[model samples]
Target: MLKKMLKYLSSLRFTIVLICLLGVMFIVGLWVPQQRLLKTVYLEWQKNTPNLVAFLDTFGLTNVYASPVTITIWALFFLNLALVLWQRWPVVKSRITVTDAKIVDPVTASGYPFRACYPILPELSGDAVFAALTKKGFTLRGTTEGFYGIKNRLAPLAFMLFHLSFFLVLLGGLVTVYTEFIGFIDLAQGESFQGELGRYNTLPIPKMPAVGSIPKVSFVVQSIEPKVTRNTVTGIDVKLTDASGSTHLVGINTPYNTDNSSFVFKHLGVAPLFVLIDPSGKEVQGAYFKLDVVKGRQDTFRLGDFLFTANFFPDYEFKDGAHTSKSMEFANPVFLITVELNGKAIAEAPIARNGSMAFNGFHLEMRDMPFWVRFYVDKQRGLSILYAGFALATIGVIWRLLFYRREIVGSVREVDGVRCLVVAGRSEYYKSLAEDEFVRLFETAVIGK
Candidate 1:
């Protein structure tokens, strides 16, 4: 039963069918928005068609690559390739080794696809002919009749390399899927982050709980600079210092990599520090509120039975009885705030940076506006193995294409006192090119001399 199962799994038909199924799944992946990569887009789809989204998510169709069914299929594919390689090892080994007993008859081998027989100069010796063939990269084994030879003898090993690469690539992908860490966090300038799960704003679960451990890394953002074009942030540059007091520059596309983890910039916004003071002149509560307000959009929060709706204007302007921002760059920042008590508006006004306002026996102060940036941190596993697989695949392809397997059989015969050399050759690949080479060997190695 085990033998039958191995044979069934290693069959070429099974491999082909598995590949076709994976291709279909790849197409489905292109059509569906995966939650991990495009949360906002997937959320939009969920909002638009909740029923369809729920069904797809339930069946794991929404995330095809990481789905249990797809992962099983990948595991099967890897097993099939491995079994196929093992079953074909004898054939590959046979091709790799050349023995004198196997090619004892040069006369019979002369009938090969590429064959030649010609007269040689009497002065030419077996050593001379062998030396010529050696210069042309042929390994020869001498026999009673003549010589049996092969060129590019290692060419057959390329197939094994190809199979090994495929196995490694699958192994790497599986390791990464089950053991990687992906999360996001928001940090204001001067705010530090230690590698802890609780500090992350969003964390995606992995397939397995074998993520090893989180990297020992800590960094504080020193400053943030955004390159704005037409009131839109085109790019963001951040300077940060690590726990070791080393500073590194990170940007939207340039992430800071350390301890096999990468810190990538995702989003940026304004975080205003607010302090609420009571009538007794004592600080009631205080914290930095990172609001997602852009272009005069209102964001609301609750503080001690009071609702505060605030709009942020970087480069504030008061024109035509309306509040607006001239640009997205942080300059002359101000907050247009409306405070409500028991759902009734109590105070509505603008508060500049470092300014204070009073309403209903309470004072609210805008302490400072600091830029906050969101970072998507990733600690990926098995990337080195994946890259090694790619390198091996490339080497296998180049080896197979550049150095093809070919064999030669040669004999020295005498007819009517005229000494002549007979040589025959054949190539498993690139027959036309090998034919030319065969002719050249016959002419230059024997007849030409």
Candidate 2:
């Protein structure tokens, strides 16, 4: 059964199937985006083919690589490779032995071509032939009566080394699939805290503030020690507390990793707010009158239940009389805000650079912003396996490619009245070169006519 299995794996059919499968996988890799957010894909689909968005969502084709079906295909490919290697081992070993064996007193055949050129060549003594071949760039070794010479025996091993390298590459890929992870974390500037170690359902922020109340949902900043020389400091140290009453400290350069998940510091910014309440039992945040100053420019603000972020231009001019921002950059950030508690607008104000809005009974203000940081988390095990496989493959390639087994056999025998030198030589690699050297050895042999 083992032999049969090995024969099947090493057969041409199995190799052809493997090649075809690999080709399909390559096509899939090229056509399908490996990893992307579902929402992003949905949005793109909606933009292109709104009708098919629902259908596409039913199948997880957007992130093809992570999809269960794609992973299964990769698994099958690995299995095929393993089977092929297992089946070919015996044959490979047998060839190795045959190629390394020393040949001595090799029988000279009557129909040999070399004998036709020099009929007495085969009749020459083995020692004489060995000595002649050695002078012709062949390294002759073994006993005087039974000698061997070998040349360029390392060429055939290249195929084995190449195969080993390929195997290693496949293994590395498999390891990466299981062990590697990729995720993003968003952080605000000047914020310091050890990020969450495990996957948690809590929001990234301490609290979700009302639309316009930025102060209610601000980062807890401990301190800001500015560096005079460098563009950025090594890291900011901050403490974090979870609901379970655990505190952890983290820095910019030094992040916190738990359960193979990591949190990285990303960016920092401040969000200002304004609040307003009117007499009609309703409340509004931020005044609309302040919008006139940056009418043509971009405006961004959060109100009681709505968040509005927009770009503005200083020399605002619109083709259809609609005010549009000049560029996306927030050179002059402003918020012309208005808020309503129920159905009535109660407060209105203009929030300018580093300003806040307030209204009756409820007051809102801008506070210091914190740094925003990004983190990545993953739970794949294939990455490590793939790396290990790659290492093994590299070793295998070097062993098989750089090293070769060589052997030469020469035997002397008395034939007729002459001391006949019979040297039947074959090389696993470089057969032509080996034969040339053998001929040279025969030419140098002293023959008694």
Which stretches in model 1 have alpha-carbon errors above 4 Å? 1-5, 38-58, 102-107, 118-126, 143-145, 202-208, 228-235, 252-254, 274-287, 293-368, 412-421, 447-449
Write down the TM-score for model 2.
Answer: 0.52
Maximum-lDDT candidate? 1
Model 2, residue 216: displacement in angstroms? 29
Clashes of each: 0, 68
Best by the TM-score measure? 1
lDDT of 1: 0.81
The true-structure Cα RMSD of candidate 1 reads 4.5
Which window of 10 residues has the lowest lDDT sum in candidate 2?
209-218
* Per-residue accuracy of model 1 over 55-94 as CA lDDT, tens digit each: 9999898998889888888889988888889988999899
Taking all chains together, each candidate's TM-score versus the true structure is 0.78, 0.52
User: Compared with the true structure, what per-residue lDDT tens digits does model 2 show for residues 1-449?
Assistant: 99887676556687677667657665765664433534455566567875555554445455555656666656765566666656666656565443324543455532222321233454455455556666555566676566656553443455455566666677666554444544444443334334343322233323321221111111233332222123324445545443345555655665554444444444333333344344454555553211212224444555555444433233233447554445433343444445555556676654454565655555444333222333443344344555665666676666654554334455565566655555665544456565775566554554522
